[model samples]
Target: MIREEVKIISKEYLNKDVLKIRFEKPKEFQYKPGQFINIKFEQEGSFRMRAYSILNTPSEETLDICLKIIPNGLASESFKEAKENDKYTIIGPFGYFQLNENEKEHVFISTGTGVVPFINIIKEFVKKDYKMTLIAGYKKQENIICHEELKKIEQENKNFVYKPTITREEWGGLKGRVQKHLPENLSKKMFYICGLKEFVIETKESLLEKGVNEKYIKVERYN
Candidate 1:
């Protein structure tokens, strides 16, 4: 896909190595909440592309992406150096991870940068007053991104619930993977999960064991 120049509007740190960057896209840009965009940057001798989920509401003029920096990672390194007003090529709002608008109850399960897409979807759900639950798993409380924002959502909407889990830290929130928090009864709700390969697989198994219909579950896996 050909890339279009998108102007950076703002950037902020979410955690130790994660960044939330907002950019300005064309007014006509329209994409589903869980869709992703392909970003390209030149390093060494070539331009490499990486996929990142869109982290803002579709109705908004600004586009956002939650990026996690990894050692020797091309896209994250280049993005870390990007400043406001800088422009770069963005290829798409792709992928099929999206909410079923007709479904009244929904569960969003995520870990690390996998939480980005859920953030976008939850924002829309809040605007529309949809019933939802967010289960985020991290290594520690400090590793949970968007902590304050999610807490506010939970407070403002009685239908919304946020649960943060830590696998390696002793914290006040739920300790363990999101799989530990799946409702005892899952016959009536929809489920969405995004995360590392193993995490996704394990969560899927747990949900199946709890009686969540296979067709009602959606997942996006990242290595």
Candidate 2:
């Protein structure tokens, strides 16, 4: 793997624990919308690495990544303490979670930070005429990240739809797990899902039982 050093351009706390960070894209770096990069930093005389999906489109000059800080996690602590212009080593353009490029209806389902890759995919690949739906699930209202951006995309493209759901809090919008909100007919739609392992397994099983072909569904799971 080729390692490149990138400078942090900016970092902002989106919510209580989630952070949105931007880095200077290396001149030689080339990646697909849904690919991820591994960031390495030194902590206690040792190197710690964590993989995060890129959230910016290829047309953008910078690389963006969103991560939820885990208490006591070396990588999370390092990110939390990062300041602008801080340099770190990055390796990759990894993962196969990308748009299929076929002209077909698409449904994207995600929870928490799992929505990172979809942001780039929609902005970079989904054309205005492409049919797409995003169903995102969060635990509470304050935890809903990137709703404004998603809404902007929805307003700009008539073919795209955004639906956000809350499971642990009362919400005026959709309420319940994303798996329960799956469209009735999956005949012509391709499904892309990302979330916790249990959620992924349950959703995939539900899709399989509903007669959706395995090849038509792509999934990525986080711990």
Q: Which pairs, if any, clash in model 2?
A: none
Q: What lDDT tens digits, residue by residue, belong to model 2 across residues 1-223?
A: 4589999999998899899999999987899988899999998799988889999998899989999999988989899999999999999988898888775788999999999898888887557456888899999989988889999988988888888999998978999999878887789888999888988898899999999999999998876
> Which 10 consecutive residues of model 2 have the lowest summed lDDT?
123-132
Tell me the tens digit of each residue's lDDT in model 1 across 1-223: 3358888999999888999999888766778888998887777789888889988888888888888888778887788888999888888868899998888889999999899999889988776857899999998777888889999988988999899889997977689878888776687799999988998999998888877789889999877
Off by over 4 Å in 1: none
What's the true lDDT of residue 158 in model 2? 83
Count the clashes in each prediction: 0, 0
Give the Cα error of residue 177 in candidate 1, in Å: 1.5
TM-score of decoy 1:
0.94
Candidate 2 structure, TM-score to reference: 0.96
Q: Name the lDDT value of residue 30 in candidate 2.
A: 91
